[model samples]
Target: MNTVPWLTILLIVPAAGAVVVAALPRRHATLAKQLTLAITLAVLVLAVLATFAYDPDKAGFQFGQSYDWISTFGISYSVGADGISLVLMLLAALLVPVVVLSSWDEVDGGGAGGGRIPAPTATPDATGGTPGGSAGGPGPAGDVGEIGAAGEIGGVGGVGGIGGVGGGSGGTAVALAAPAPAPARPATVPPVETRGEAETHGRRSVPAFFALLLALEAGMIGVFAATDVFLFYVFFEAMLIPMYFLIGSYGPVTEQAQRSYAAVKFLVYSLLGGLLMLAAVIGLYVVSADNLGHGTFDFATLRQMEITPGVQKLLFLGFFVAFAIKAPLFPFHTWLPDAGAQSPTGGAVLLVGVLDKVGTFGLIRYCIPLFPDAADYFAPMVLGLAVVGIFYGALLAIGQRDMKRLVAYTSLAHFGFIALGLFAFTSQAGTGAVLYMVNHGLSTGLLFLVVGFLVTRRGTRDVGAYGGLAKVTPVLAGVFLIAGLSSLALPGTNSFVSEFLVLVGTFTANKPLAIVATCGIVLAAVYVLYLYQRTMTGPVVHEENRVLHDLGLREKIVVAPMVALIVALGVYPKPLLDIIRPTVTATYADIGKSDPAPTHPAAAHPGAAHPGAAHPGAAHPGATHPVATQPGGHS
Candidate 1:
């Protein structure tokens, strides 16, 4: 059982596959892609099987394994999962295959409008395929349109592909509180000639692209499963390399803008965060050495020592800032939009969906538990930032031009909600926070993946260029709608459950913050629906949009599982909730907080007469009356 080393296998499988793919001959790219697929799928399978091996009843780490990796440094290779980590781990395992499938055609230069790092240079026509269409300039003949509900696509980002998804041309266009008038037509979309549907131009580089994907997967899994602080830092830092390459190469054809800037920006931000964390790590080690007689980076060992409040706060900032930047919380969120906008769909998928979550995860799994006093002390300030991020991100999303960037901004808002729940210091809120991370990954991943599909067809990421896309691509539009609905946390979608729990849980602990955070949901609805309406609804503004293909078999295969999970988790979240609740309760104990009881009117007014007193023997909700005192004063 314990001898099986399941977690180790999960880490090694994809990592080993990456090496194998890298070694394969470049000419055999198709074969490399196949091999990479098989390997990723295998890892996904193992992660699933590993789930069965997990015990929900175990409130502490499960399937624990440790080995002395660097004994002199007091470092060890320790790996395990609890309810919180398990859900996130499963989310990672689930997304990799889907990401692979979604990218199958995209990498080959299919219908992406724009949002890639540059593969090898294709000609202008090869780039856009239109004679006059320069990289950043407008195309001569292509139907450039406007996207977004308000007036033109100027204020909001280019979301112009709508009036087809149920937003009719007349009044519906202005329904989302558009203070401006709808322009007669979409703005000029660059005339990038889309390669016909059957095209397969970039097949040669498939292997290299997929190899990087596998590497990223391995890093993601390792980061979440890591139990030792030093080991966690290793994986945390290791993931950046693959992502850097993914962003630098194999990206969308932005007209003239180079993905190099985005890639470098992402790297610098990440490295800065890592440096901060490394300092904290060294500090933690030194403290342990001075007090415990040995320096150790084991999460368990670190928690055993009682750090002073001052030192805890200082260490907490070092770690918190690292996680915050990684979380890309409001002020630190500048890099994400650029990365999301410039990186290719597959790269963006892992980048936004799974990779960024490392920030939030670290806060819960490391920072708070290791520095409970600091976590409690900074709770109010953190909660304020979370609320501000929620509103701020949604507003920015509502104004984005690129679909990728819009989705990216929305994540900023969602992350705010997740952070709020975690810092609120209640079991329900914290559990909801963990659940939100899982659900956000799924829902947002779906959104990004669908946007990738549209970009593929249009050869442009401009929303305005697409009008009545639903008419031409029904299934694609439907998928977009569902994904959008999920993003808005619709009642029947998985996001709703988590959002509700966070708000409810936060309400019990911090009513004012919870109330303010609730506004995020409303803004979420506005931006989500507006994006969908602008892109998928209305009349077909562009004749070019009319001929685009619908979601292909591969694309459907990519999206189906995510959609299933969204609805399935929405209907009944117990399985996930069951796995999450115990670990969350444990986290509560780690941070020294209790789940506050929901306020009751009766409890609030002990002096009031119990209604049952007037109907002592009648049917009642509580079925009790103040028989002892006749005024609900039983005591």
Candidate 2:
């Protein structure tokens, strides 16, 4: 009944901003970037205000607004925020601005006056020569013994000269031989002046990139705030367009073909999942019609429907598969590595840090609450898959060479933990799962941003490419270590609290699985420390690494808040837990489940008075009088 339409405004601001930014002249690229950052910041402020307005004591969705959109079909334009949705909305808003700041230099042509700046190439060594050369001249050329070899000589050595023996006059021999053959330009390549235009011709414009980012922000907010099932689906699919372009056209990879392949793979997997979910959505509508005498896609109404277990199982598979694919759990996780590795840094932050969370959110929001019976039936199988993903992702992460892919795999493992908590059917576990989602976004987002900073300097993702980076970029190394430690759920970090809660809750229900999952913690430490040791420690072997600069002003600005939050939340989690716990309890209550009670061996003895038992005649352990429950009093 809230009249402000807070969720709608949240959706419109960014969506409207995307259109305006996209329509700007190409020369206004800097304006576009600045404007996009401002808009995201505004959204963050609004999200915070909304959180302040939300009442944790409330039992239902807040800031809710609804209107019948398709009366005949029972669909509505509805939106609201619950505790889970509010936190996630805040998370998405928080990261988008950080991503923009981190990507200031990564996006091509974001310079002043919106002019196209050429992408950073390998740094020239001292004496004004490429890294390939030892001295100031061109790299050493291939030896030519005969006239035929001379033709090959022209193409052998790098810029400066062909068959250059050293820094001496020999470096210029190839240049004088044949004028360097005009560098043998590709037939399809455009002239230098027009190359930027060509790259931006179809879908690679700088304005488009910023526009897509804003649009993506809108979509992410919409997904979390939406209350109508069909409306959720719309936002779910709409976000993919921007992500596709972000991955394919604007990725950091130099090879357009590789970016395109990764983009296509991501698109294909998502579309398949979407198709399955679409069928399930329609199935829900049909089932609703059969029961209620009309079809409806209203989530609240749908949750109230009494679904038969058999049909619930069918619908559950459809939704579960789609969400699992989104979660990219184990077998369906192949697309993520390529996509994450190929995406632009800002895009990657949103990809793993926010977008991938939709799957787990859907499981909590729709799969469990709407189909509680089916969820209970399938909990065991899902838990097994989650456990498998934990180890599978951890093992793969330990073996990855690409830093981006390694981070992506770590997310897969973390998702397993989130999934396990959700299925554990306890309030503590569910609350921890929700908290885990937020912490993962903060910690992993920091990890991705830091990696992007490193890649910006080193120009490579290979772990072996770096050694003793801490020697030169000590601040950067320090930040990277903190991020890695957080990822491994180190004590006194935010992840450790949520992770601990998950294990403790799971142990109460399923001891063996909880114990097995504990091993993933060790594996997390192994991969995280191994990554840190390989990249930041040891002797500085590469000369390029020696010159690497530490984090600059902007980079520090990007990381400061994240680090503060990670540490702050680790120390005092009571605020977030207070907000999240009530919803988790309500959700379990709706499912007709309660926390499992603990038992002691003494309870098995006959005629034994339990110390904590309430009875009319039971004597207090230390008090002078016997304790008793009043008549008609509830336990």
Candidate 3:
């Protein structure tokens, strides 16, 4: 079944895992978690195979499977993977397993983190992960939280219960107890986790927690994989439910009011956006029916319809506002900070890393392609707002004391950059924007995981509470620094390449805007380095931080893939770029734009006698706009 419908299986596997986890008893919470993790990792395997199996040289929508769901209305269970969707699907699949492993101790509390191990100051604490595949012992990262300490603060969570479980009315549901022992470690190494010290710890609703996480994973994959316009909308709105529950029921209970408010705010904003899109959907159907004698919501079919610029503009706004809310651009970004504060770390990782991408993805996949005129009309306005968001988000992030909220705001900045690359409409810019999505997911997800570790160990997400952390938890400090560098688009990191392409692309389109946006990069470095300096570099004045342990084996495993990708993509990004270029070329064709030629300093002046004779105004003379290919053949 190599030729089987892999995209459908990619969707169904996590869904099946969620159902299985839901069916299991709370007493089997450990087993349910293990099973769910295995299924997610297995999906990762599938994604890797799909990537290799794909013939990157020739691209369109590969692995396409369309079937009639509503024959009368022209909607169907249509799904496919192109270079663009494939990378995102891989991102969604990759993160679930890492989040599972990183939060393993928090959820199950199988052992005391630092009670059995020597502190980093006393001796090297190698109780956890090595650099790569192994979640080796918390090697020099430090001896973090002591046994029986409160882990990540719960707006809706508690030390005594896993799911804050309630005994069921029908007979009696099984109550979750202790975390099961992890798989046996090599005998040469000392037992870093002292289970006896952590026997009283861990959450009680393990089965329920895994079920919710798996459900969210499934929704994310479906959103990226759906090809039909109607199917895409269904997945778009459906992904929000698990997130709502995760925030409302899984955060620190002390901040229950804040968590509840955040959840409600998120729900209200998302619902408002969804309703607008729903109205636009009906309008599209009606318009298509009048023009083509049948109602249709096929993305390809709608692209071919000769809708008037007026109608296209109206439909575009409905979709754009929804996407903008999802993107959480400057004026629309107020809801994100609250939600980030209240969400569980894993939930936050998925929220900022993957779910937010759906908005930008919608812009690339639907809004622009289907409404080229509207997209062109709005390009200047959108680009203007995007530049505003970049500066606005950076300034706010620099001023924030809360770690989670700071990370959330940075995402706003990154999304603004992605939006800029897209509206510039150059192939280089488009390719870079798509690559930015994948790289941003890796770097930001790592930052959240590290912050989660700090919050759980210290009972605070406030930056003011931390000082001289690098002296205590060196490895964590290092990880945080790397993430910061990536955030600020430091040279030799994944983000720099994408950001460079965006600047180059924007310059050809709008010189003044490009110059303005470039200043945002300077602001990015300011916030990133300032946050690091305040938290990790000062004297270790706090008594509680002195004993903090470095990364454990489990935590190392969580970061290895992310670290590898950051460097891997930085050095050679061809694999992902190859996958992204074909679809980007197609997008350009849909919008009627040409790849602007590269300009060199010597050849840039209009009167200069150079081979390219490059003019700042248009495509190079006598040369075809290489729409479906890269400059040097493969980026």
Off by over 4 Å in 1: 1-3, 110-204, 601-635
Highest lDDT: give the candidate number.
Answer: 2
Which digits, one per residue and each the tens of the lDDT, describe model 2 over residues 447-495? 9888877766665678888899888889889999889989999988899
Per-model TM values vs. the true structure: 0.82, 0.82, 0.83
Query: How many backbone clashes can be found in candidate 2?
Result: 1
Q: After best superposition, candidate 3 residue 543: deviation in angstroms?
A: 0.8
Whole-model lDDT, candidate 3?
Answer: 0.75
- Tens digit per residue, CA lDDT, model 1, 519-587: 788999998988888889999988768777887777778899999999998888878877876677676
Give each model's clash number: 42, 1, 41
lDDT (CA) per prediction: 0.75, 0.77, 0.75
lDDT comparing candidate 2 with the true structure: 0.77
Residue 560 accuracy (lDDT) in model 3: 85
